[model samples]
Target: MLYGLSYIFTKQATAVASPLALLGWRFLLAFVVMSGLIVVGVIHVSFKGKRLRPLLLVALFDPVLYFIGETFGISHTTASESGVFLACIPVAALLASAWLLHKYPTRLQVIGILITLIGVIVTVLAAGASASLSLIGYLFLLLAVVTYALYSVYVDKASAYTGIEITYIMLTAGAVVFVTMALIEALEHGNPQALFSLPVKHPSFAVAVAYQGIGSSVLALFLSNFAIAQIGVNKTASFIGISTVVSIIAGVLLLGEAFSSAQLIGAAVIICGVYTANNTFHRQKRQSQIEKKSD
Candidate 1:
């Protein structure tokens, strides 16, 4: 739920700040906090040489690009719409898995993916008949989905490195790139006030940016790394399904956004679909293990 709230706050934060500025603070704060953890020896840090390339890839695809796409996309679209699009992530993972490994998706997996599509449609309907969403906005959200899908797959191969090391390296790498972009953006669009602004414009906005950087961007990565370490990558990825329901509830309660009946129905449908998809993977994993044992 902490991770889910991160998305909600991110949507609200971007309302008052540019997405790049938001990303800059988020990466910077998260990088600083994580660096502290390492320096204090609160978290043991280590990396595997063979896994360096893939970790870098996950960083680029997930943080550098995905965050940029999602933040800007939310600015352009409604939270409801963004939530619906984000829900497709798990389904995207399934499809990618099938494509790359020739893993035959179960009938239930296919059905779940289709049902989630229906949920997205219902959510969009709840946005209203006349809601003017731009295609550019939708494109950005889709870009997030695409980048994250690649990250999801690539992270599996990144297991040669510990999740802690991967998280630190990726965030640090993303921060370096984001900071450079932020510096250039600040220079090119030099409204000195905007460039040097702090907790003044909207302190809540600053809080939002900080929360995204430290909570969503940093802590989420930490938890994901821990989860993937304890459970395997595929198992940990199932938890991502929780983000859909979490986002809607948080959007409503925290952001004071109202959900239409259609959205409620969509949320319920998404829950059912997530259960089906998660179980499908679980069953397949168990079956594979059993087959290996038999051999």
Candidate 2:
């Protein structure tokens, strides 16, 4: 749900700060909070004896590539267009998980995934956005989807790592990459000092940064990794694109955006899809546990 809110606050942050600047501080703040948690013994991460390849790849795929693509893609495209693109994450994630982790979804789960995807397309297109973006924009969005999928699959593959550990490294990498990007952009504009001053000057950026850095980056990514570890990727990815629905609902409730009947129907379809997929998985899980206990 916080991912949905990230969309809303991202608009606010972008209004006050460049995308790279906003992402830099957003993740830098998250990294700071994560560091404090480690220092305070609130969270623990271990890197002893484990090869760094999987962890590094996971971080590279996620906060690094995913954000770069997503940030730029949304910038060049309309929000509704981006929503339709974001809707493809679960399907891509599912395929990646199946190929990489060998975690195939049940037929019923695939149907549910398709249902949710159709609902997202319906909801997004109901806004009547024309398909009119440059090829580069479309390619960026595609990169975002593919990188996000790879991230989900790698997180599941690296099941030895705890959620805290995965999220810690992801945020650390994000902070470094985005801060450097922000620095480069600032330099190109001949205003490097803006990186430090602009965020402090804008109250809107401050509020957006707090929520995005803490709630969305730190907590949400941790939960996502935990879910992927526990439930495997496809099941967790089933609800991946539901953020579009949540963003719409949030806009209606918080920002007083108009909510249409088609949107309401689309939201219901998404919920039904998620519930149907997870419900079947739980039932099968329980049945297997019962059989094991009987033996």
Candidate 3:
């Protein structure tokens, strides 16, 4: 839900601040909140042997490349178009798992993936003539999907090896990257102060930034990492399809956006696909575990 709502906030915030500037403030605040949690013993931080490189890679894939692509992509493309593309993250994660972990998706899972993709296509097409497509915007959104998929896989491994401490490190690294990017964006705009000034210039921008910082960045990241660690990547990724549904609802409620009947049907189809995929995965996993125990 936070991830879905983040798109709405990002769109609103980007109206007042550059994507990089919004990201800088978002992650900076998230980092501070996370650090305070550590200080108060709400969460512990530890970096033991041989985990730094993978943790850094996860950070780079996520907040750095993923946000750069997603923010810029949404700024340039229609929300429907962006949502359609972002819906592909689960499929990308499935393929990444096949390649990286040698864990190929089952036939049922493959069918679910195809159905989910078709549903997203139907939903976006139902948005009608207003759904504009920008090639550059799609390119960036695709980058977001790929990089985030990679992050999903890597963060699962990192979490297993080192626990949720990696979340803090990832957020810290992301904060630094976005702060630098914000400065560069400000420089390009001929006002270096815009990095810090823009958030204060608009009240809505500040609220959007804060919601993204605490809800989306900090809480969502922790939940996602915890889910991946507990259930593995394919199951975790399957739930991403529901974000499309959440995005649609949020658009209607928060942004006052309208959806066509076809889009509504598509949303239902997406939910069904996610359910089918996750259930199939769970059954197969249980069978595998049972067989192993018997052996």
Candidate 4:
């Protein structure tokens, strides 16, 4: 649900601030809050001897590119539509697994991916350009979804790092990248003071940033990494619907976003395809065999 609510938060932030500035504050706050916890010794994340390459790539893909694409996407599209587009992550992960992990997708998974693509097309056509859906927005959301899939693949590779360690690196990298961009944007606008003054004028930005930093970036990321470690990536991907469903409901109820019957039908079709592609029974068994052989 945290991931789902990220859209609502992103949408709210976008209304009050530009995308780069929003991401800047969100990830900066996340880095500061988590860093404070470390100072207090509430948690520990040691990376001295651990391999950092894979986790760095995970950070790049997720909290960096993922947030940039997602914030921009949400700015251009309805939160509900962003949620639907994000539901395609599992399908993207299927492909990523094939490429990164050398785990070829089964026929059913391929069918599922194709079905998801069809659903995406149907939803887009149903939405048209008239109904708050922008082609640019959908394309950015697609980029975000692909980054998330890549994140999962690399996180699987970086099994040596604990979840909190991974989360810390993500927050650190995101803060560095976005804060710099935010500064550059402020400079480009010749209003450096606005970086601090904008959020002060818009209190909603602070609220949204807080939720995103503390709830989504820190705690939720840790939980996701833990789940992936415990149950494996495919099983974790199977639950992608939980976030999608929550995002849809939150968009409709909280934001009063209106969606059409065709869009609803497309969402259902996407969910079914994601479900089919993400089925883990035989895949899990096979993955275990592969792991054993590798070990």
Query: How do these models rank on lDDT, best leading?
Result: 2, 3, 4, 1
What tens-digit string does per-residue lDDT give for candidate 4 at 1-295?
8987887887788787788998788889999999999999998989988887998999999888888788788779874577568767877787788788887667766776667666655665565534465999988999999999999889889999988888899999999999999999999999989888867898888889999889988889889988777765665665665565466668889999777898688778767767776675567789999999999
**lDDT per residue (tens digit) for residues 1-295 in model 3:** 7888887987898787777888888989999999998899988876655657778888899878898898888878986788778878888999998898777777777777767877877887787635556899989999999999999878866754444577787789889999888888788889997667766778889999899999998888888888888777887787786767787899998889997899899988987787777778678789999999999
Expressed as tens digits, the lDDT of each residue in 218-253 for candidate 1 is 778877766645654444444565566677788888
Model 2 TM-score (2 dp): 0.96
TM per prediction: 0.82, 0.96, 0.89, 0.79
lDDT of each: 0.73, 0.88, 0.82, 0.80
Alpha-carbon RMSD to native, per candidate: 3.6, 1.5, 2.8, 4.9
Q: Can you tell me which runs of candidate 4 are displaced by over 4 Å?
A: 71-88, 105-145, 270-279, 282-295
Q: Higher TM-score: candidate 1 or 2?
A: 2
Clashing pairs in 3: none
Error of 3 at 54 (Å): 1.6
Residue 95 CA error for candidate 1 (Å)?
1.9
Q: Give the Å error, residue 291, model 3.
A: 10
Query: Best by TM-score, which number?
Result: 2
lDDT pick, better of 1 and 4: 4
**Which digits, one per residue and each the tens of the lDDT, describe model 2 over residues 135-172?**
88888999999999999988877877888999999999
Give Cα distance to truth, residue 246, candidate 2, Å.
Answer: 1.3
Estimate the lDDT of model 4.
0.80
